[model samples]
Target chain A: MAKILIVDDSRTSRRMLRAILEEMGHEVVAEAVNGEDGFVKYKELNPDLVTLDITMPVLDGIQALSLIKKHDPEAKAVMITAAGQRDKMIKAVKYGAAEFITKPYEKEVVEKILKEVLAL
Target chain B: MIANIIANYLINKGKISLDQYYEFFEELSKVRAKLGLIAVHEGLMTEYQADTVNMLQATMDMKFGDLAVEKGFLTHNQVQELLRKQADPYLSVAQVLENMGIMRLNDLDLLMKKYQVENEMSSSSIEALKSDEIDRIVPLFLPPEADEYVAFATLAFKTLMRCADNNIFPIKGFFAEKLDCQNGALQFVDGDPCLTAGMCGDGNALLGAACKFGQEEFESVNMDALDAIAELLNCICGLYASELSQKRITMELYPPQYDDTIEGVGEYKTLIFPMMLGDKLVNLLICIGEKLEFRYS
Candidate 1:
């Protein structure tokens, strides 16, 4: 299983993601509430995967992803978006997000994406 | 101003501490009550019935109107009227000015009519006003797109109040009802061990209220509960759609439809999931693209 770092501002969302990732046998290395912390965590823990939520306060997922990639060109990050955020998702993809997810999660779809990203 | 009035009233009556008053005021600002009150005033239910339910809601683990309706104290139509009666008390320009000690009642009355004309509000809508509950009406005014989630949930919660014995106020968002279950959707938030699935069959959206919240207590079987469940579906969709605004994919919600039989099955798996809200049992189902069925808490 891949080591993962979760980032988002909502306590509820963070709690939910931690439980699911742990259940899937993935090690949750760290968590951050926004993009700045996410960058710091990525630099420190260097987890195999980072799940970055886009609409957080301070720096957002896009900025965080770019910073992480700049630090390590091969860094893998997954972008989390709300439903109508298609525009942001495209931008994240261009910045080299490994994959994408939507909120109010669906388990299998998440696992499938995680597996796919890990394989890559 | 309404928040201040509520806080002041509660404080003067010694019902809430100063700190609690501030907290309640903050909470009141976040709470949306307009649409639910409109539902009540539009011949939905009697003021007494809604008040009684609202009172019952505050103390016991009981819902407001649902208990009254179940006891045969009020009809569905009456309850719906009561919902409309719960309109925003703060938005009445005259009342706001009067309450602030700036205007007299007669002057306020004349202003109400003129303001109504300027805003194109019907006389009937004005007549539907219940002066005592104005605080409840103003907050429901969200941008148009945001109204879908609020309307669906408000309606669902009102229905639950009319039907159940429990009371739970919505605390967070009127999350839009639409969702995009793209890969890795579950990584953002966590709660409950859940089965994941999806379906793509044509389904109906709810009518009447803005948002819906579903809770099942002790497996009590009520056929009408199906309507409640459907309303919850609408809330989920609205929240999902709202979250996707950043992606620029706008989703239009279709009205809810209902038929008697459960005849068709699709490629998606079906699982019954549970969500815990205090003592409430929240059963949720996830369907993807008309194929897989999954349980979600």
Candidate 2:
């Protein structure tokens, strides 16, 4: 299990993700509401994995992902989103997002992705 | 109804075990709870009324809401309102299964038509009646299992009919502060004690329903139903808050959270209440302090 950071605007999503990750024996090191806070938390906690939501106030996921990569270069960040953000998702891939997960998550899929991202 | 048909078909074809069917049914129950909560939030009726109807429907051949109306508990307009408040379940499910283009609309339509015939509604008079007319005729389908999927599917079907029948957008989403008034509350995980705080949302005809419903039936609020209900509250909050904020309320909303079973003892009373949805009781726990202590049942 890997240490994880969850960044999302929705409390429900964050809690759900925390449950799934913790259930799999991974530790959720920290969480942030927006990409800006996420970036700050990223610098402070430096957890093994980060799940960043693409659409957020202050700073969006792509921007935070860029900032994290700037500092760590090897930051393993996953972009999370709901439907209709296809363009932004494509951009995250280009910016080296470790993976992307959609909203209304499936536990198994999330567990598998975390394991895959942590392996690297 | 469709699920049972599909499950039966699968059973006959030797595709799944009976145990799998039971598990699916259980999950579907959660979904139904979610839908019932949404309907209540939409101001269709009170949680107790919905619960009463759900229980009555169990032993009798009657529409859940219809039973309530017959008992003089809810007005026809209220039943119509509840029916109108429903959203499309197939669309929700489809959104969840974005990758699988498995079920076609036409196929589902045929299944529905077949279902209509199987129940022996062959009279041209019944067929000619409008969709809403048919809906009033059969309020609840009472499948072998009342699950989340079934509830969602039922809501979707009703929503479509309502849209087609009424030609109106029943509700729209917006974020504002009057909606954000502390008047709207969060139910905590602890025992029956509630916090009387302002909630974020648009204060409208709906506020009366939210306040009354929140206060009436639930001691420990139902989370799944609350999430669905809160989505409307959020929309109402968004619209109401936008007007109050002058600037849009920039704060983001977290998804709905819930826990059915909790055990503890404390004087720092927590505010979470239980609201009725159909036959199920759902709880909503308000998170105010820095951390929430919880254990799931």
* TM-score, cand. 1: 0.37
lDDT of 2 at A18: 89
**Each model's TM-score?**
0.37, 0.39
Cα lDDT tens digits for candidate 1, A57-120: 5788899999999999898888876554556678899999989887656678889999999998
- Candidate DockQ values, in order, are 0.09, 0.03
What DockQ would candidate 2 receive versus the native complex? 0.03
Model 1's number of clashes is 98
Q: In model 1, where do residues sit more than 4 Å from their true spots?
A: B1-297
Top model number, TM-score: 2
Share of true Cα-Cα contacts across chains kept by each model: 0.20, 0.00
